[model samples]
Target: MLEEDANAGYRRLFDDDGLTFGAGFPLTGTNRSTPPIEEELRLASHAESVGFDGLWARDVPTYWPKFGDAGQTFDPWVWLSQVAAHTDEVALGTASIVLTLRHPIHVAKSAASIDRLSDGRLVLGVASGDRDPEFPAFDVDRNERGQQFRERFEAIQALWREEYPELEGEWGRLEGDLDIVPKPTAETIPMLPTGQARQSREWIAEHGDGWLFYHLPERTLEDYVADWRDDAGEKPYAMAIRVDLADDPTAEPEPMHLGYRAGVEWYRDYFRRLEEYGVDHVIVGLESEDPEEALSRFGDEIIEV
Candidate 1:
């Protein structure tokens, strides 16, 4: 069976027969700054009610002027745990968690706890991180991001899948005497590496349960899907796109950063093409004045139609 078929969280977000969609958090679509969250919990519940398959949270350890934005202005674990409480059934994803800044011990424990709390609904997206200032702030050498990312990933897997597994790495030692509590509801939680993750494509194909990538043009996406199929077979592939939806359903698509400002008619076509090209899931970050209405419009016009 495919990984998506095997893992509950993975299955929630991906299916072999057709594509699925997820709502990116900070669902209000505020960029380059923190957005208010008075309605976030309600919106999360609303998203699930409207047929979204997943809800994604981002990992932003600290705010930096250079950083694009504060991701939901909350820690991913706390936010997802809260989201898991208010909503059920939607896959709870980390858009990703920066491995270099966190110890795998913590990640493993948190993931296991959350998976058990949410009943195997956690799908982890791990990344090497791209912010320059965060490196020095965390006292980690920028040069060692890739190595740390790999080591932490392995450590987390060991903790998740094995009992008292022996391991020694830059993080610390697990000397075959101690164990992390709260293993996932499944055999192990799903781990999807985001972006290149400072690792080779072959490495990701070998280790990742799935891959989370940025938006790409249709021509590029087709080639990406083809390459992914060749390397990873049917392992699920998911991508993120920022959308500025228009009021008029018949309006044509106009290019925007990492996505399009298009009407619902064009929206339908784009999603169909994505599915045809073998993309498994699309994480849509909606940019709009009234995000709640946009969410309804997207669900009514694109997903339900």
Candidate 2:
């Protein structure tokens, strides 16, 4: 039942009508190690009920001691699967999971498990990781991930598709006709790499079902998309924005990290601008002092768009 409705929702957004909006996966932490899972689920359900088309989970394994922001404050897969069970329609996805740290076989199994449990409402985004400390903790080399990411991606793809497939790589070797069970209902899980991780835009374009980017000024974003399309031949593009909707409906624009604190009117205008620029999806991160208020207010305004 959940899978049926979730895929139906996916078709409604991408297969049928084109443009859609989603809230970036929300975690409540004012500089903490993690937030309670219960709170995360409540926030996720709020986004779904408020008409968010998708929810993005960030992977924040260790505190990384030095890194200031601790990202999404939970294990991405565990949190996302719990949220998936709680909601029926909103597509559950990772903003970008660091594929370098974990083995590809494990990544394949976990992702396929979530995809099946969620009834095919899964969009798995992969990246080579950015933080420096995380590598040493796992006794993995930070420098070698770029090469590993490519190899791992290939292995995971083969594991998902062919039964009893053999895979060879520097990372590890899979021999003797092993078949990964529980394939994704979709032909492939959406494998979007965040930014250029030691790969050229041309290479990224040739691959990647879609492109993911941080927030940029509307005109700059337009130019960026144009450049991406020029290199990409013809693939969809997506971007995420950190949004902090002020309680004051008339809140004016103020610069925030990767986003702006603005009123609902400006927010709508901004999304319309993205639509005009031919963007396929926009993931908004509502990071206000009061997340509930921010989500409620944004839902009343932007979700209706």
Candidate 3:
């Protein structure tokens, strides 16, 4: 069986033949700039109440004016822990933590801590650095991000699975002398690599517990899923989409950044198609003036289908 098939977080949020849904954080309408984040906890709890399988938080360590987006506007670790306290039974995920910029030890410790705190509900999505300015700011070599990402991933796994693990790489050197505390609730925390992370498709298929990808057209997504199944049998495939659900139930789809602006009826059909295409989960970034109403409507109409 695939690691995702066995992971507690994955088990809670996905099934073999059907699709589950998660709401991205900074649930408020604010994007493009720093979100106030005042209502995130309340909205997250509501998402769980409405049967959302997971609540995703993004890791944006610094604001990049050029990038034009501030992901959740809080430290992912601190924010996730706070959100964990307010909700029950909802999987808490980091859409991705930039592994190449941070030390592997910290990522391991923090992820394990969240996993334990959430009672094995942590799904850690990791990535290589993306924002160009961030690499130089953190003093990380942009060209070496791929190598650093791989090394960090390996180091994190060893720390979680072995006691006093001895690891040597660019991240650091660990000689079986020191052990990282608070190992994941299970043998290891589920790690889903986001995007390519500058790694080969084969590498991701072999190493990741699951694959988290950006939104794609139906045919494109179907092809990607087929390739993934061929390479990594039975592992889950997840994607993120930005949606602006219209008030009219029969409104047709119009193109948006990563998704579409459509009605609840249209979304229901769209999501059913996604399920048929073997998408295991979707992390939806909702764009709405009244986010609460949109979320409730999506849960009642789309997710229940």
Candidate 4:
């Protein structure tokens, strides 16, 4: 089965037909100059109206001054809460949050709250984080984040299920006679782990509801999926890819980070391969010079496949 079909949260988002497209924002502005969350919500509603299935935001910290794209330029949860309220049925997601820097309780609370606010239309993609520059300011060690991420991830999961969850780890201790209120409508939020983050395949499969991966060749992705299935028992996985469409529909492919600069035809072929290789949904990131047109083109051309 495809990844969306297998994951409970994804199935809820995309329904039975499978593939869905979501627009990632700042919908219209840069990190340094975000217009307003309202503009993004408008774009999101537009996307849904035009048949895109979901929308996602990025968690960009102020301290990471040069990350260029401050991604949506707002607090992810708060922005998602607004979008959830305004839009009727679009799946709202955080393309990812940097989990290593924040407390597990906060992650649990914010994600649960968003899920509730959206009436259960939230997809939580989390990661160990890669910005070494921001770690010191938070008083967190850059080198130790991988280990910290594991401990915190476990704590959050426990908090979701076990009342008064007590966590003892090298990072810190949460000995709680307290339970996090408002567990996800599902037993837990559908958390997708990005890359390895020092987690073994066994750990990812057992812990992660799904895999959030970057680029891999078709054969390699198939192998990775098989390995993940073996380790995870029965779980789903997803990938994010960028497409830069040329004005010419037959432009040849050129490599970019985790994606390509190619024509819509190549994109169609590439997406088909991803599906054939068992990807349930390919979250498309349009980073072309023309964002609106790129989005329109993807919807008009490739989504038909």
Model 2 scores a TM of: 0.91
- Which lDDT tens digits does candidate 2 get at residues 1-305? 01232333345345523568777765454435566667778888887777778888887677866777666777778877888899987887787888888888888888888888888877766788888888999888888888988888878888887777788997777786577887777655667677775667787776676677789887898998889878864456778888877667677889887899888878788788787786777788777666666777777788675
Model 2 alpha-carbon miss at residue 216, Å: 1.9
Give per-residue CA lDDT, model 4, range 1-305, as digits (tens). 32532323456553544555666676664556664666566767776666667687877765356655567777898888888878877777777888877888889999888888777788877888777677887788878877888888888888887878788776566677777888887777777788886678788787787787877877889898778777765466677777678778899898887778888888777777766665666677776655566666678887755
Off by more than 4 A, model 2? 1-13, 16-18, 29-31
lDDT of 1 by residue, 109-167 (tens): 99888888897889998899988999999999989988999999988998988999999
Per-prediction count of colliding residue pairs? 0, 0, 0, 0
Runs of candidate 1 exceeding 4 Å displacement: 31-34
Which residue segments of model 3 deviate by more than 4 Å? 2-7, 32-34
> Can you write out model 3's per-residue Cα lDDT over 147-250, one digit (the tens) per residue?
99999998999999999998999877999999999998889988889999999989998999889999998899999999988997878889999999887889
* RMSD to truth, every model: 1.4, 3.3, 1.5, 2.9
- Can you tell me which runs of candidate 4 are displaced by over 4 Å? 1-9, 13-17, 63-66, 170-176, 217-219, 288-290
lDDT, model 3, position 274: 84
Q: Alpha-carbon error at 193 in model 3, in Å?
A: 0.8
